[model samples]
Target: MTDHLNVVLHPLVQHKLTLMRKKDTSTGVFRQLLREISQLLAYEITVNLPMTSRTIETPMTEMEAPMLAGKKLALISILRAGNGLMDGVLELIPSARVGFVGLYRDEETLQPVQYYFKVPDSLKDRLVIAVDPMLATGNSSVAAIDLLKKAGATNIRFLCLLAAPEGVARMKEAHPDVPIVTAALDERLDEKGYIVPGLGDAGDRLFGTK
Candidate 1:
């Protein structure tokens, strides 16, 4: 079985994440760091992608060269906060098909409310990757993945900058087949459902909303 949770402990990824976690990191700097770290995560997540060989001429010789086998990819951003994380991944995988799931959490119930959802066609043919910077309660992430599966995404992976134990447990219970890759796994979530030691709200930090 695939390891359900993967913490990218690469020194570079961890270093950048630390900088991102600081409270005073400027929006521009935070965004740049996220982009850099995101590219690294993108590299890690795609390491084992299926490959096929294609005939190609190198200088003066014809040879079979390896290339990705299936559809380029379907990158599903779990809206708002997810948008912050996707741009960096996009920079690395420019050919990937992009989609968005718009969900807002209701404070009282901490349930996800979907306002918008759209994804690429033939989702099952592509390796779908869902991006969300913070996996705090896992409610939004789980709901987003549920919707993606309903839309025909069979091969899916979850990517995030930080993950809480509660969120990781929630995802494992809900979608064990989908592996999760994150920069760090923090201790737990607070009463307000925020990840402890998390860099506040990812969307707010990314967009300067708060």
Candidate 2:
């Protein structure tokens, strides 16, 4: 993926991810960890956001204070696992707008088929961040980004909990302009298109299912 992927190696993030990866971690605990770690990832992803200054008076004097330069951000969740990450990001950026792109992978073909998509208007004026828990084959992530661009989102970033090498490569080839921020990039995708040594199905783990 060249230098497009940002693997957050913060100690706290890695620690929480380790616990989340364990097979015995309860669904409630896993969901909590994801929420917490997602906030940290959000911090990293927004680090270089464009900033400008605004004049403000502090009791005695007026001074220039830094403020976000662009329109309210658009947080697009690639459901249903993306919702887990989205909740945490929204905690930090409460004013950011939210949207959803529903897609399911064809197990046999390993391709993405979009079923639903709804996004905030004026995406071209905002910094659109797309969130999802796992980036496996990258089919769904790429497809989601495609839809976002078609809707007028020129600036976009991808946030994920875990990623496989194949998925990263796929995204790099398809959308080199979009940067990827992830907690950990795992080994590879297994035969079933699941990240090997991953935390298992993220949506199921987040919601607790077989």
Candidate 3:
């Protein structure tokens, strides 16, 4: 195993993470926090994206300014909870193409069962950022990326609100080429397959369900 996974740790992200970790935080607060946090994390994740220079008039003369030059990025959300985080990231990158991956786990089989998936054409040429709110078992996240690769996504990055250590390791072993960006890495998963000390079921909190 690599000594460390390539994870982005930012200060604003840390503070927002602390707020989200609190048990008393309300649903409204939680949603807002997720949006703000996702935007900050998105900033960190997109820092290294390839850029090209363009000449623009600066009141008097045209000078070269670096700008994202290639195809608009692709934001693939892993359904429900991922959509919440996607809202914030989209606020930052408004022009990014959006996609959805819908997978429901089969209780008896203990495997991800894909229900729906749709992505933009020419994914191989665009920078793809696949996001979800939580990464617990890593099965669904890894599977989602596998589907993206199958659809010709060459440059891809995974982003999430929170992650467990096991999930991190799982992704590393299964998809080493894809770097992961998360707000916080929590403790181990509980017997029920939930991240310990996590913000509880992300979908539940986002949707106000049990």
Go through the candidates in order and give the C-alpha RMSD of each one to the true structure.
1.2, 1.2, 1.9
Candidate 1 structure quality by residue, lDDT tens digits, 67-120: 989788999999888988899999988999999999999999999999999899
For all predicted structures, in order, the TM-scores are 0.97, 0.97, 0.94
Ranking by TM-score: 1, 2, 3
lDDT by residue (88-183, candidate 3, tens digit) is 999999999999999865656546789899999999999999999888888899899999999999999998988899899889888888988887
Worst 10 residues of 3 by lDDT: 1-10
Between prediction 2 and prediction 3, which has the larger lDDT? 2
lDDT for residue 208 in candidate 1, whole number 0-100: 85
Mark the regions of model 3 whose C-alpha exceeds 4 Å error after superposition. 1-4, 107-110
Better of 1 and 3 by lDDT: 1
Clashing pairs in 1: none
TM-score of 2: 0.97
Which ranges in model 2 have alpha carbons more than 4 Å from their true place?
A: none
